[model samples]
Target: MKLLSEVEPEVKVSVKRIDGGLEVKGNLEELGISEGTELTVVATEPVHVHAGPISLRVAGKETVVARGWADKVYVERGGATVPLLRLEAGEKGTVGTIEGGKVFEDFFALLGIEKGKEIEFLRHLPDDTLVLKIDDHEISMGEGQASKLMAEHGGKNIQVNYLGENEKAKISKIIGGTSLKEKFEQMGVVEGKEITLVRKETPAPSPKRGTYVLAKLGEQLVTIGRGLAEKVWVE
Candidate 1:
């Protein structure tokens, strides 16, 4: 066991309640963390564990958690932290607290994506479309149009490149006159929607033409041009 702030780098610690609050022992102090700081355990394998406020990443090197408030400590697995919705499956957790509620908790609610929500991943279709199953329903998006909606999950900085012929796309955009700040909401793009990327062409130089995303829009795959895709940011 280690103190609340003396844990070694990448050492995953189980959180437990003590004295009406929470406490973590063992090398916790090394990270400048205290008894009540919210920590997101970034990794829990091969002698690695860390807790922090922002996104945590585990790798061959020591695990690191972004420095910040402590509360509702999250547990991680593999190199990627488990989705906050799935953290209830772990043990040996280190307890902590957050001031404005749990970051992970709020993220799912805001996005309308939850752990129990079912999603399907599809690849390599005869029609060159990207298809997915959500809530037991089958949905398909043209490959050209898939990338735009998929970009919503690009927050981890993931990029996609692929295009198909005969696919028509529409630039996903928010109506300029509308007060809504999100294009996804304005365009009716949400979790469980089938989307795909049908093409990747470099239309610019130097910095390079950004990727274009196409998505299936209820029986029609609409191409989302580069400009609109860039404007529709996702976490």
Candidate 2:
């Protein structure tokens, strides 16, 4: 077995043993690193590893070991690991682990992304942006954020935005803040609720204007701005 810091880039490895005591082992475990776990070394300088479905890096460190803390992680090469951002269009993966702390985890959970969920890589846009199909939503994210996710590839899903007038769909997720979520929730826009597109008005001839969409939620008819409509994911 070799220390994780010594593993060459692109090598697939499995955790053999962690030589650290309770504190270190506990911390590593929180990041999804432990004996029998498989991962891949994605980078050497400022070491980064794809552990399970999460991508981790030694922040501010030139190597994987920080003050010898991570050196205790001994590994043997041979296992599968892939970062979500590396997946090509038409490919898919199941979320395994999330690399950050509670706050980051909670943030993503609110967005309907969590461990065991499957995501489909849609396509890449200009300027390091990419689209991912999560549930029935097409979410656009930056490359940096995508790099933090790791997954087991091979799944499929379709996501869309526009809907024909009078078309109905079931809400899957809402991407917005607490107030926005609360506002939508009060109008019966919560996940699993069916909504119907009543009417859509094209944007006015103004640089600072947006399209307007009328939707029916339960017994109520709500007028949603273009920006808010895009954040409401549905099937």
Candidate 3:
């Protein structure tokens, strides 16, 4: 068993284990070594190995591993691996398990990272520049810095319920641009009308507080502040 970093480039080797570490033996381009990379052994007449989920074939006829190393190396496809925290634009790859011990796993978990989660690499590090959307609302995270915001999302359903009176009407004009509040008004929500909170469901730890009622009028739906809604004195 040899650590990928410890092994010399182009040395014949094989993988011996995958838990808590990766073992491989082969004539490899060490310069290409990266965390969470997948690999496979050659079988049948085609003497070669495949790497990554896409199974990019390596060590073809020209570069074959010694049979001794081939039998010892172990590899898995879509097995347990942690995705690395990517900080570049358009840079994408799956995660493999951490090379270190339990401490590494715990620390990564604190960063809201887990195996098998697909993350979009972002370019910046501050001011919500990294774009990630939950439930279709796009939010900006600090550029390349989104990886630090760690939390787990246990699947949960949050249902939004509508209440209060409602007035149905079509929109005739829009008062503003595409802001949520503006769109509501353009949908016939306006002052002096009543609407109910519609149903909404989402996972646990929902960022939204609760549902809202819209006042419908002309071609717009005017959104009233929660405080103002309480004072509406609905009849």
* TM-score computed on alpha carbons, candidate 1: 0.19
TM-score of each: 0.19, 0.26, 0.20
lDDT for position 43 in model 3: 15
The clash count of every prediction, one per candidate, is 55, 1, 42
Q: Which lDDT tens digits does candidate 1 get at residues 18-96?
A: 2222212212222233344333332212201112122222221111121221122332344443323233212222222
Off by over 4 Å in 3: 1-88, 124-235
Better of 1 and 3 by lDDT: 1
Q: Can you write out model 3's per-residue Cα lDDT over 79-131, one digit (the tens) per residue? A: 43222221134444343344334644453343333444343333321122233
lDDT of each: 0.29, 0.39, 0.27
Better of 2 and 3 by TM-score: 2
Each prediction's RMSD to truth: 19.4, 20.7, 27.1
Tens-digit lDDT track of model 2 for 127-232 = 2333443345444533322232322222311111233444455555554346546644554446555544444333233343444333322322222234322332
Best by TM-score: 2
Candidate 2: C-alpha lDDT: 0.39
- How would you order the candidates by lDDT, starting with the best? 2, 1, 3
